[model samples]
Target: MDKCAILPIADLYIRVSTEEQADKGFSQRYQEEVLRRHCEVNSIQVGSVIYEDFSAKTFNRPQWTKLFKSYKVNKGNRPQVLLFTKWDRFSRNTAEAYATIRSLEALGIQPVATEQPLDITVPENQMTLAFYLTIPEVENARRSLNIKQGLRRAKKEGRCTGLAPVGYINRTTETGVKYIAPIEPCASIMKTAFEQIASKTHNITQAYIHATDNGFNKSKNCFWRAIRNPLYCGKVPIHATPHECEQYVQGTHEPIVSEILFFNVQSIINKKREQLPKRSNIEYLFPLRGFLTCKKCGEVLTGSGSQGRNKKYYYYHCHSNCKSHLRTDKLHHLFVEQLKSFKLSENYYPICLKILKRTLTEEAALKTKTTYHLTKKIDELNNKIKKARDLLLQGDIDGSDYKKIKAGSEVQINILCEKLSALQNKQRQLSKDVNTGLSLFSKLRQLYEEGDIHTKRELTRLIFPEYLVSDGKCFHASPVTGAVKRLYNKEHSFTGLFSYNLSIKKELLTQSDSLIIEQENYETLGLSQQNNVSTSEVNEVMSLINTLAKIITIQLLK
Candidate 1:
C-alpha cells in the first residue's frame, strides 16, 4: 500500500484583510489555488475550503469557529488536517498560534502552513516554525503603526478619517483627496428634527415620527445618534489611543445645523432624559391628572371614573386618607382661565420688546469681548502645539514627551473652542430669540389651549414652577421670573406696569453687574461649581432688569 493514499483529508482555510484583497499575489483566489495544489500533490483528500475577510489579530474568526464546531460534531470521521497558504493566514499572533497548534494536535488534527511546512518530529524544526510565525506578527505591528501615523497626519490636516455619518456622503476629489459632502433629504430631515426639538414644539418621539415619514428608515438608536452627533455642527472628534489624548477639531465640511440649535437640542435632550422616569405610561385625556396634589396631605392626586345614573364621570381625588375630589371638567376649565392671566397685554408688548432689545444689545457687547479673549487663548494654544511639533522635528524633545505636551495643549484648546462656539452661537441667535420670546409671550394663552397633553404639561410647568391645588382652586401659583410675576399681579395698573422707577432701575442695573461678577466667580470655581448658577438664576437677573425697564417705559406712555 502506498503511504500517500493513506494520508488524512484536509480542510483549506483562506483569509485576506480588506487591504490584502487589493494585492494581486495575496488575494483570496490566489491563496485558495496554492492550498488546493499543495493538498493534491500530497495526495490528501480535500474536505472543504473556508474563506474569510476579517483581521487575523485574533483567532475568533467566523469561519474558523465554524470549522471547529464541524470537527467536534463529526470527530471520528472528520478531516484530520487543516491547511493554510501561509503562517500569517493562520494567525499573526505567535503565542496564540502556538497554543492553537497544540490544541489541534490534541484533537487528532494537524495544522499545516503550505508554503512553510514544519516537521514536528524534529525538535529544531519547532524553533523554525516559531520564527516563521513571528515574522507575520512583526509585519502586522509595522503595518498598524504606519496606518496610525497616516491617520494622525490626515486629522491634523482637517480631513475626515472614517465613514461619513448619516447626513453626509463620502467623496474623493480627482486628486484622490477624500472629503464629506451633505446628502439631500437626510440633511434637511436632520435640520428640521433639531429645530423641532430645540423649539420645544415637539419631543424626540415626535421628531422621530417626522423623520420616518420623510424617508428616514434607520432604527431609533441610529436616529438618536444623528441627533447627538456634533459632526452635524461642523466639528470632528479625533479618538485617543492608550498613549495619546482625544481632541475635537473643526471640520472642513459645511455645518447642517447652527451651533445654537445643536447646543439647545442637547440641553433639551438632557432634560428629557431626566424626566423620562417620571413620565406616566398610562394615558390620561386630562393633562393635569398626575400633576395635581392634595394641599392637606401633599399626596399626588390620582384620577378615576365613576358610574352615574346614565353616564360615566371622570374625577381626580387624593388616593390617601384625605377625601378630596374634583371633577376633571371643572379643574381643566379653571386651569385654562388661570393660564390666560399669564399672557402679556397687547399695549405692553412693544415696550417689553424695546427693553429686551436694549438688554440683548448690551449682552452682545459683553459676549463679543469674551469671545475675542477665548479666540486669543485658542490661538496661543495652537502656537504652543506647533512649537512642540517643531521641537520634536528638531530632535529637542522626545516623541513621548512631545505627545504628552501636545495632548495637554489640545485639551485646553478644545475647551476654549467650545466656549467661543457657545458665545458666537448665542450672539447669532439673539435677535431670533428675542422675536420668539415676544411671540410666545403674546400667544401664551392660545398656545396652551391648542396644545396636546404633553405640550400642555410643559406649558404648565413653565408658567407655574410651583403650585398647589385645594378645594378645586389653584393657589401659590408663583411665576417663573420677576417679569411674569409682575404681569400676573392684579394690583398693578396698565400704566403702572409700564412705568419704571428710575431709582429701582438703577439698583437693578447694579444688581445685574454684580450678578455678572458672581457668574465669573462661579466659572473660576470650575464647571461643577458653576452649575450652582442655574439657568433660572441667569434668567431671573435678566428678567428683573427687563421688568424694571418696562415699568419705567409705562411712565413714559402716560
Candidate 2:
C-alpha cells in the first residue's frame, strides 16, 4: 500500500513593538495577513499563529518559549515552517536569531521571513540573512542611543524626565512639552515638613505625622525620600556617566523650599542619624547623666541605684576603675543652686522684663510683615486659579491643563494659609510669649526642681552648655553661655552668675570662668520620660525653654 504524502505547513509568528507600531507602521494583524498570503501563494498548509507584544531583543519571549515546547511535545502534528513578516520581527539580535533558526532547522522546521525570504539549502543565502539581521540590530541600537541622549538633554535643561516625585504631577504644555508641577495639599504638607525638620521644631517621626495629618498616605521610606529629593528645592540632579559626574542644575519649576532650607534639613537629618538614641528608664532619677563627666577619666558619667539597709540610693558612676561616684540628690541640689544664682534682684526685674518685651515686640512686628506678604501671595494664587477656571470654561484650555494649573495654585495657597495661620497664632499670643520667654531667667530653678525629668535634663544642658565635672565634693561646668556671666548692675550688688558661692548640704559647685552646653548639643529631642505623654507636647515645652534661654542671651548682650 502507498502512504499519502504530507503537505508543507507553516506557523505564522507576528510581533509588533509599541515603538515600531507608532513609528514604522508595523502591525501584528498586517504582518499576519502578509504571512498568510505568502503561505497561500506557495500552496503551503496554514498552521497556528503565534502573537507577541514583547521586544525582539532576545528569543526568551513567552510565546516563543511556548511554541518551542509544543513542537517538542507534538512533533508529528507540528508545522514544518516558522514564518514571520521580516527578519527584525523574528529577533533584533543577529547572534540569537541565527541560533534560533539553527534550532528550528534541527527540529525538522525551517524559519522563514515572508518579506525577505531566502532558501536555507543555498549556502550563500546565510550571508543575505546576516545582512538583513545586522541592519535592524544597528537601527535598534541607534534608537536606544537617541533616546538616552534625548533624556540626558532634557535633564540638563532642568526638565523632569520620568514620573514626578511626591507632591507633583506630570503634565504637558499646550505645545506638547512635558513637565512636572506641584499638586495640592501634599505639596503644602511637604513644605511644612521640610520647614519643621530644618528649624528642628519637629523630629522626622513628628514631621511624618504632620504629613499624614495633612493628607500624605505614602510609607515612611517614601516620605524620607521625598524630603531628601532636591526637586523640592528646584534643583535637578543629573545622573552620573562615564564622561561626567552627577550634578544638580536649577529647575524651572517653582520650588517648595529654598536651597538653604533644604540643605539645612539634610544636615539635621544626617546629624540625627549619626547620634545614638537614648532610652533610659531612670531619667527622672538621674537627669544629670549626659551632662556630667569624670574629673579623672573624662568619660561621661552613668547612673545606677545601689541597695542599702535604709533605701535604694542612686549614684553617678565614672563607668571606670577610678570609681568616681556622686550621690544623685546632692548633685541635683548643686545644679538647682547654680540655676538660682542666675536670678535677678528686685531692681533688675523691671529692666529685664522691659528688654524682653521690647525684643519680642520687634520680632512680632517682623512676623506681622511676613504674614501680610503671605496673605498677598495667597490672594494672587487664588486669583490665578480663578483665571484658569475661566479659561477652562471658555474653551481656551483643556480639562487636563486646567486641572494641572488649579492643582499647582491650590498647593501654593494651602502653604501660605498654613504660614499665615501660624503667624496669626503667634501674634495672638504675643503678651503670653513675652512672659514665657522670661521663664528661664526668673523661674528656672523652681521649674527644674518641680518639672519632669525632661525639663531637668534640658535645664542641665542649657546651664552647663558642656560637661559638668565633679569629684563628690566640688563640681563646675566646662563652660557656660557667656551671657549668664555678663549680667551686671551699677550698684555692683550682684556681679555675675558664677560669682555666687553656692553650697547645698556641703556639696558646692565651685565658681569657674567657664560655660555650659552648646545649642548644637541639644540632641535629646526624642527623649521621653513618662508613658502616655505626647512627644509633640514635650517638643513644645522644650522649645519654650530654648526661647527663654535665647531671651536671656539677648537681654544680657544688650
Candidate 3:
C-alpha cells in the first residue's frame, strides 16, 4: 500500500481562555501530548501543531489563519486533518464553528476532536456533531454571562473591583468594601511626589529624581500619569460594562493627597503647556518676548514676515497703527538690561502670613457651623424619641405608628452621627492646614525663585491675576483685597517696562564696576570678557534667556 493510502495525519489546534488558564489544568502542551498519542494509536502521522494563546471566541486566531493558508496552498495535496482537544477549544460560537467546518470540508480537510465522538463525521452523525460543538459553545457563552452578572451584582452591593491604583490597596470585609491602607514603597513615593510638586521647588524631572532616590523605579510617563490621576485623592473608577465602557463609578478609597495639592499640581501642568515653545522654520524678530511692547500702541510688539534686498527678515512691528519697527537683536539686549532693577520688599512674608491667618479663622468658623448642625439634629432626634415614648405610655399610638416613629428617629440619629464624624475629620485636616500655611508660603517663594521653565510657568498662573500688553507697557494686575479697598488703599501695579529698563542700566553699571576692579588687580580678577561668542553658543544663550525671561515675567506678575 502506498504510504499516503496507509497513513492518516492531522494538524493539532489548541486554545484556552484567560480565565481557564488560571483555574484549570487544560493546558495547550498537555492537549498536544494527548492528541499525539491518539494519532499514533490510529496509525496516523502528525502533520503540524498550530495553537493560539487566545480565547477561541471566533476564527480570527493566528493558528487558524495559518491553517487556512496552508489548506489553500496545498489544494491538491494529500487529505489534511485538523485535530483539537475538544469542541469548545476549537470554537465557542456555534454558527461560526459550523461554517468553519464546512470551509475545511471544501478545502479537502477534515475536522476532528480528541474528546469528541468518533462517529461525528458519519452521515447519520449530524445530531451528535451538533451536540458536541453547539452545546459546548452555548455552555461557554452562558458561563461567561453568569460570571459577568455575578461581578455586576457584587459591585452594586458596594464591593470594590479591578486592580488597585498605585497609592491604594482594595480591601473587602463583612462590613463593606474599603481602600484599607497604602503599599509601603509605592505609597511613600506617592506622598513625596505630591509634597515635592506642591512645594514647587522641583520640576517634573526633579520630582522624578526625588522619587527615584527613595527607591522608586517607575517610568517617567508613569510618574506624570500618577500625578494626573485623581485616584490618588481616593476616587475609584468603576467601568460601566464588560463590553462597553460607557460610564464609571467612583469607589470609596483612602486618599494619598489633599484636594488642594491635587488642584495645584494640575494648575502647574496647565501653565507649562501654555508656555511651551512652538517651532518655527523662519526666525522671528519679536523673539525677545515678555518685554518691549509697541511704544505707540498697547499691542504686543510681535514679529511679522518681511522681504528686503531679495532676502527674508522678521521685523517687530506694531500692527495696531503704532507704526514702528525695531531689529530683533537691539530689542533683546534692551529688554535684558531693563529686567535687573525689579525687587520685592522684605515685608512680603509678613503680608502673606496675615492673609493665611485670616483664612484659617474663616475655615474654623465654617467647621463650627457644621458641628452646630450635627448637634441640632441630635437634639431633634432626642425630642422625637421622647414624644414617641409619651404617645406609647398614654396608649395613644398603634404598633405601626410606634415602629414608624422609632425607625425615623434611628435614621436621623445615624445621619447626624455620620455628619459629626465627618466634621471632626475636617476639623483635623483644617488644623494641619493652619499649622503648615506659613511654611507653605516660604517654600512656595523659594520654589518660584529656583524652578525650571515649566515649574515657573505653573507658579506664575497661581500668582498672577492677568497678563495684558498695551501702549508699549507691560504691567501685572493683582486682585485688590476687599479689606484694602475698605481702607481706601490704591490698586498696586507692577510694570515690567520700567523694571526691564532699570535692569539693563543695573547690568551696565555692574559691568563697568567689574572692569574697574579688573584694572586694579589683573591676577585677582581672573575672568576676562570674550569678544565673540560662537554662533552655536549665541543660539544657546538666546534660547536660555528667552526661557528665563518668561519665568521672571510670570513670577513678577505673581
Runs in model 1 with CA error above 4 Å? 1-8, 14-24, 27-42, 45-54, 192-215, 258-558
Q: Is candidate 2 or candidate 3 better by lDDT?
A: 2
Cα RMSD (angstroms) for every candidate in the order listed: 12.1, 17.0, 17.9
- Cα lDDT of model 3 by residue, 1-558, tens digit: 687666876878778776777645578778888889988888778877776887777888876787688778976653568888788888888889889889888887788888774665677888877787778777877988898787766555444456666666767667764435568888878877887666564566767766765677778898888888766765443444434332223335567875556656767787855442443323222334443356556666667666678554556677676587766545444433333322322222232333344455555577789899879989988889889889998999965676667756764575567557766776666544533443444344554445544554454443333433332333333442222221122232111112224455334323311122212211221212242323443333233323333443233222
TM-score for predicted model 2 compared with the true structure: 0.52
Cα-based lDDT at residue 135, candidate 1: 95
> Which prediction has the highest TM-score against the true structure?
1
Model 2 alpha-carbon drift over 4 Å, by segment: 1-5, 195-210, 219-221, 265-547, 550-558
Residues 472-538, candidate 1, lDDT per residue (tens digit)?
Answer: 7654454464445545444431332333455644443333221232234223222243344454543
Model 2 C-alpha lDDT per residue in residues 1-558, reported as the tens digit of each score: 322245688899999876667654478768877888898788888889888988999888988899899988997987888888889889999999889888888899988888887897898987888899999899999999999999889989998888899889999999999999999888999988897666554678767865775588899999999999989999887776765655677787888887767876877888845542344534447788888888888999999888889556889998889998999889888777767666644333433444456566667678889988998899889899899989999999987777667756764575567667767887787665555555546667876765545556766665556788877666754565433332322343232212222243112212222222334311233232433445454444344444555544333321
Ranking by TM-score: 1, 2, 3
Ranking by lDDT: 2, 1, 3
Which run of 10 residues does model 2 get worst, by summed lDDT? 505-514
State candidate 3's TM-score: 0.45
Assess the local accuracy of residue 391 in candidate 3 as a C-alpha lDDT between 0 and 100. 93
Listed in order, each prediction's TM-score against the native is: 0.56, 0.52, 0.45
Error of 2 at 313 (Å): 42
